[model samples]
Target: MKKILPLSATALAALIALSGCSTDTNGSSMPGMDHGSSAMSTAPPTNVGTETGADHNAADAMFAQSMLPHHSQAVEMSDIMLAKPGMDAKIVSLAKDIKAAQGPEITTMTNFLNSWGESTTMTGNHSMAGMLAGTDLDKLKASQGTEAAKMFLTQMTAHHEGALEMAKIEVSGGKNAEAVTLAKSIVSSQEAEIKAMTELLATL
Candidate 1:
């Protein structure tokens, strides 16, 4: 029979150490590879795809609804210039081409707007088609001879530029694929016309 003394603290510590306490060879606390290294060792988790939201639903529609009649106005102006007397053949030829190209487009886009249930007349409460400012149309109506040709070219060039600008806005901001395609086509065609007009302007 023996009286047992309470275990010393040093003896208990040694007993705990012997029960598999571990430390790095370099005296670091980590018993295995560091957390950062272990984390890096894992294969990167697969990424799930993300959803992209739609943009410019109404603005795209409005731009299309507005631009069709604007294009028609340009075609109409070209027709007027073509019919005017003493017009330069080069200019007249360009006017004819513009009218021919644009008239069909007017019909096409108009059909699109109609199908979309948009307003057709430009003079209503929600007028989108700018049917020419009154003064500008009056000036066009009064012009004749070389003056008419010059005026028409000048006006039409500006008009085409305006369309191109609208087109560019749609290209960058509008989400409708058909509208964007049409806008890019407008840019290409109008830029070519602009170059043609500039050359014609130099001659006059």
Candidate 2:
């Protein structure tokens, strides 16, 4: 003789069966019953488009031109430290990150300058804030081991601070939406790195 299962047991079995199959918004196979949030998943970037015309300004041009060389110098300083003996790992990592981020910004800024009919090369005194000088660079270069690492951290922290200042200026005075966006990004990313570097300096 065959026996029927209890109602609760039947319901549980039905739930399991339903969960085993699912469909997407387009009626495609959902597979594996992904009840979890797809919102958490990263999607490929879509064509959000770019800003044009009056959004750009002279301030944006200047910001890009000056920042290109400034960032280049920072990357240079970091490279120098990376090659030195007995360098701190934290500082070395910071240097590598700085090089990675700023080089791309330099290219973007140069492109902006070219598009805007402005000079890609740097101009004016870049001594805005936290910018290093001849003596400071020399000190960083000549130091050894932990001292060199410490100097690099200190100097780079200052450099990033300068970048933050410039970025703030761009946010306030820049006309181009894209330029301001990049400026804000600079402020956000560099400021975090500056804090990291500062904490690293304290440890050293």
Per-model root-mean-square deviation over C-alphas: 17.6, 15.4
Task: Write one digit per residue (lDDT tens) for candidate 1, span 1-204.
Answer: 133334566666765553333223332333264465333333232121111113235656666777887887887788788778777899789988998888877887676556555565544455432357868888997888878878887888888877877778788888767767888888999899999998888788
What digit string (tens of lDDT, one per residue) describes model 2 on residues 76-156? 898889888767677778888988998999889888887666777656655557767778888888898888988888788
The best candidate by lDDT is: 2
Candidate 2 contains a number of clashing pairs equal to 2
The C-alpha lDDT values of all candidates are 0.71, 0.76
In model 1, where do residues sit more than 4 Å from their true spots? Answer: 1-56, 121-131
lDDT score, candidate 1, position 202? 79
Determine the C-alpha RMSD for candidate 1 after optimal superposition of all C-alphas: 17.6
Error of 1 at 11 (Å): 84
